[model samples]
Target: MKRWVLTVLFLAVTMSSGLRADSSDQAAAHEIIRAQMQAFQTDDANVAFAFASPELQTKFGSPAVFMDMVKSGYAPVYRPRAVEFRDWVDSPGGPEQQVFVIGPDGRGYIAHYMMERQPDGSWRISGCYLEPLGEESV
Candidate 1:
């Protein structure tokens, strides 16, 4: 990905890296989300599909069609500028789900991301639940 693209995405992903993940690793995961978001924002189906997990890619197969749905369903409220991972829950068989607070709108977005431990012992994101943080009415 381009440096500016990485810069934009890295801002949000850097938060996830702290204590639990770290700046670099979080940046990488953020890149995935960034690519997906950029695809939706720009209406670029190919770019968006490229960011999907292998499972999703296999299931959908058509980037344009899937991008249409993503644009229609999720492009409205995804203005994420910052992200902070709050809690880490470990399940016996399930992937670790991280609760996060995302800023630029100050809302909650939960990432049920699968983590893979690298040979160096650091964790990188494998997959995640990407959802918009809905606002609560006062």
Candidate 2:
């Protein structure tokens, strides 16, 4: 019923009119993502859930529900064996951070993280699109 699942699961990431992120934005964005990943690693659902946008938070209702959905549908993001920051694109929606990930299954994938800049100037993940890059690590 919501667009986040469909956007991440079914559609391919094809962001256009994007510009590379400046160093400051890149650092901040990457830091938040890495922190979220660490939260997942430690099973801190509340910490991990905080990285999501307010809109997403409301959609899932609670940290537990958000974590469950991520564990099931976003395996790579939830438990990435390896994570590499690729491109930080400034799209119409916001800054779209593309990450290269090695999944728990040992497959390679690209995670397109749609970020939202809060009024306070912090960032949160609004949506994500995961695509299979290859069987081998990239």
Candidate 3:
């Protein structure tokens, strides 16, 4: 009985500490994302592109291509007026992702942006899902 009780107590403490640490890391990632968005809004593509993962950079081939896609594809929704970031979900079986709620002119979308931590300890936006809320699951 004593062994079981101690085991339970130890697990509880360890789990609680882990949860706290995860929450803090999540918060820091959000801050980094907000800054990235600000850079994009200011048309500083270089700064905005700095947040992406190396794999993404190679896949897209060049930072300019990446930025162009972002500007044209979601530009309507992500324009300075409609974009707002909220909610973060560490991707299931994947990296941490963020939710951006965008709306204006009678249209809107919930964008799920996947992010990765850069060498400098900043989160960079790497991938995104531009879709209506609850419309699809993957």
Query: Largest lDDT belongs to which candidate?
Result: 2
Candidate 1 per-residue lDDT, tens place, 46-68, comes to: 87676665556667679877666
In candidate 3, the residue pairs with backbone N, CA or C atoms under 3 Å apart (3 or more residues apart, or in different chains) clash, namely 51-124
Q: How much lDDT does candidate 3 score? A: 0.66
Candidate 1 has a TM-score of 0.48
lDDT ranking, best first: 2, 3, 1
Q: What is the lDDT of residue 137 in candidate 2?
A: 78
The local distance difference test score of model 2 is 0.87
Candidate 3 lDDT by residue in tens digits, 1-82:
9999999999999977776677766777677667667777777877777766787778877767877887878663346345
Using lDDT as the yardstick, the better of models 1 and 3 is 3
Best TM-score among the predictions, by candidate number: 2
Clashes of each: 1, 0, 1
RMSD (Å) of each candidate, 1 decimal? 13.2, 10.8, 5.1
Per-residue lDDT value at 91 in model 2: 76
List the candidates' TM-scores in order: 0.48, 0.82, 0.66
Worst 10 residues of 2 by lDDT: 12-21
lDDT preference between candidates 1 and 2, better one = 2
For candidate 1, the per-residue lDDT at 125 reads: 40
